[model samples]
Target: MTGTDTDAAALFASARERLVDAPRERLGDLQEGRRFLGIPRAARIVPRGTAWHLGVLLLTDDAVLATGDIVRSRAEVRRGFAAESQRRRAELAAAAARGGVPEGATVHLGWHPIDLSALDAASRPLALREGDALVRWSAAGGWMPLARYLDERVELLRHPPERA
Candidate 1:
């Protein structure tokens, strides 16, 4: 890899390594726009027409850097990821049954809505430096497996939907 690539990878790894099981905040306990440092507790993949998106990818960067819904540690990150994934899986299925994920859209890591229908205009997707983009994310690394992270999360803004 190029020096820059190597450096970036190292930087990403260091950030991920720093994450450990620590105290975190729950989603409902969070404010609308308040900023705090925390981990990604769970993620909801809301499907628009052409892409899948996370209503919010709870973060775990640090209480000092940012905040929202918090996941305690790296383990919680994994657990939340899996749990959210399962939850969204069912949600997507139902949505598909009702309408369908656009003609070419596909769901990777998906989850059910933390709430079936609710829109708090004050609620903005949290942005944290992960992988190459600062988007609402819920993973240990900047980049994650398939639909878990990567371009999918970064491009979430491009998609639109009611809720996960």
Candidate 2:
């Protein structure tokens, strides 16, 4: 995530403060490929303000305190983008398999560029992955590289969620 130096610090600080007193038991240690996702729910916290949607948790082997709101928003955006990208990929793959080039001999995956300039300090802690969701660290004092976290979480979901 891009942000001014001061803004980034503030965002990091808020996340740390929120987790400071949280129970260690509540803050479980995720196994390799496991994530601690919250329920798929939405809330209208204010009478006039926009409602916020929650995202799935992607627990990691490493300990980090991820908030529900940030995860939900990132997951929703990633899901939308990933769907569009997959659709285009499939269309191009089918065209190629049929032994013909697309109309312009071009295959494109829709890509979006996010504007980080408008993000204030508190939300600037998150990072958007190229093919995955945006994520932020739970701790202000310790930081982990996001790529490793994503790789581990993806492996855990390989078997798919159990059916109720």
Candidate 3:
């Protein structure tokens, strides 16, 4: 979701272009996507098979914020992070209680960060998140060390995706 000023304009243009010649029934949904993405006049949207659900793509100064059926603000993301963090901690505890993985390895969870310090250097994950799978961080830089994952994410949030 990081790019230059032109990327933002092009993305918005692509999104807006979808509006013209669209069916009347779909206009409302398209407008909703625009509103959700906080774009002025454009947003590329794909049907999620529901009136309120849509695949949205909107570009900002730094990155394209894409999501399926959800438009959220920074505060919302922070709350979600706190909740997910607590859930993951509990899950880790439960897993440990039931005999966790041995040294040099760890379980992978969609929202949890696995500790790689105890493992060998070669086995370390440069970064771990819902990305690529949910964030696609690997494409940005697989060379990044595991310790820098959080910092990378925080940086990615340089601009928060907003809702109308």
Candidate 4:
């Protein structure tokens, strides 16, 4: 195989080894609720603000694929009949029924592929850019290589810092 092909295969293998699966109950919720083309090769659920963001990675035969950010807001009661709030409530209910989400959390599953052009102004700074590699673990932490990002993220999820 060519050098590039070999490198890609190595990267894919590394990612596969480092990847951690999301909670089993949430897999179907993520697939059907988020409308993913198929089950992600690997996924990680990390807390973001009062929400949880599911970071997904899919290593396909031809390319390394990822979703933009699958966010689910923390559960809370809304007093108004605002359309958005109503929609969120319904989404939360569906996700809860499927055991994909915790109580009261609202799911926002958009089909956005992670790419340079696809990133908006707000998301650009957070994404790491190395030639063709661009990825983000959270809203903070600036930019970093994909492999480093995965390693650090996996470690963080496994051993979160104790809150002061």
Q: Give lDDT: candidate 1, residue 150.
A: 29
Candidate 2 Cα outliers beyond 4 Å, as residue runs = 1-121, 127-135, 139-141, 159-164
Local distance difference test scores for all models: 0.31, 0.30, 0.29, 0.42
True-structure lDDT of candidate 2 = 0.30
lDDT of 4 by residue, 1-164 (tens): 44433443465556555443422112122433343587543222332222122245433223344434344544334456668867655554544435435754443333233343333344343242333344554466455555565566555544557981
Candidate 3 per-residue lDDT, tens place, 32-88, comes to: 223546655322222212111112222222223332222211111122436876654
RMSD of each: 18.3, 20.4, 20.5, 10.1
The most accurate candidate by TM-score is 4
C-alpha TM-score for every candidate: 0.21, 0.22, 0.19, 0.42
**Local error of candidate 3 at 77, Å?**
27
- Which wins on TM-score, candidate 1 or candidate 4? 4
In candidate 1, how many Å is residue 81 off? Answer: 27
lDDT of 3 at 64: 32
Model 3 lDDT at residue 69:
21
**How close to the true structure is residue 67 of candidate 3, measured as C-alpha lDDT?**
28
User: Model 3 misses residue 8 by how many Å?
Assistant: 34
